[model samples]
Target: MPKKTEYVLRLYVTGASPNSIKAINNIKSICEIYLAGKYALEIVDIYQEAEVAKKEQIIALPLLIKKFPLPEKRLIGDMSETEKVLKGLGLQS
Candidate 1:
């Protein structure tokens, strides 16, 4: 049988604003608790790398984009909605 692939998660944030901080922190906590050593995460600060944001077509701050494992997904805002994020990322039942 073929093997199942894991996820490559990338978070694009505008800056160190409160929303961005929350999103980063929440995602990191989730990844550590759930994803752990199986996933790779990159926090891209759009304020420092505006080109990255433009390339990703990010229209908002605190955007979390799941890049790998096929069928990419995006979550906006502070990532305060943990269950929703987990569900959308295929990390929850």
Candidate 2:
């Protein structure tokens, strides 16, 4: 049997803004439902980690980056749309 794919996700947010909170909730829900135990999620607050944000070249708030499993993908917004987020994460065709 093939090993399950492990996803590495990084979410860059700006403080505790509503959009950032929403994004965090949405992504956490998505990962729980979809990726489950096969994913690693890191939430980074740009306000607290300015250097990390600058190094990542983050120009938008509530950004989700899928850094593993190849062909890195980025999505920006509150991540309320499940289908869109799934597609961006390569979980859907």
Best by lDDT: 2
Candidate 1's TM-score reads 0.87
**Each prediction's whole-model lDDT (CA):** 0.84, 0.92
The alpha-carbon lDDT assigned to residue 45 of candidate 1 equals 84
Superposing all C-alpha atoms, what RMSD in Å does each candidate have to the true structure? 3.4, 2.4
**Clash-forming residue pairs, model 1:** none
Name the lDDT value of residue 72 in candidate 1: 93
| Residue-level lDDT tens digits of model 1 in 1-93 | 543338788898867799989999999998888886778888988889878766889998788889987789988888888899898789886
The sequence of per-residue lDDT tens digits that candidate 2 reaches over residues 1-93 is 554659999999988999999999999999999998889899988998789877888998899999997899999999999999999999999
Residue 69's C-alpha lDDT in candidate 1? 73
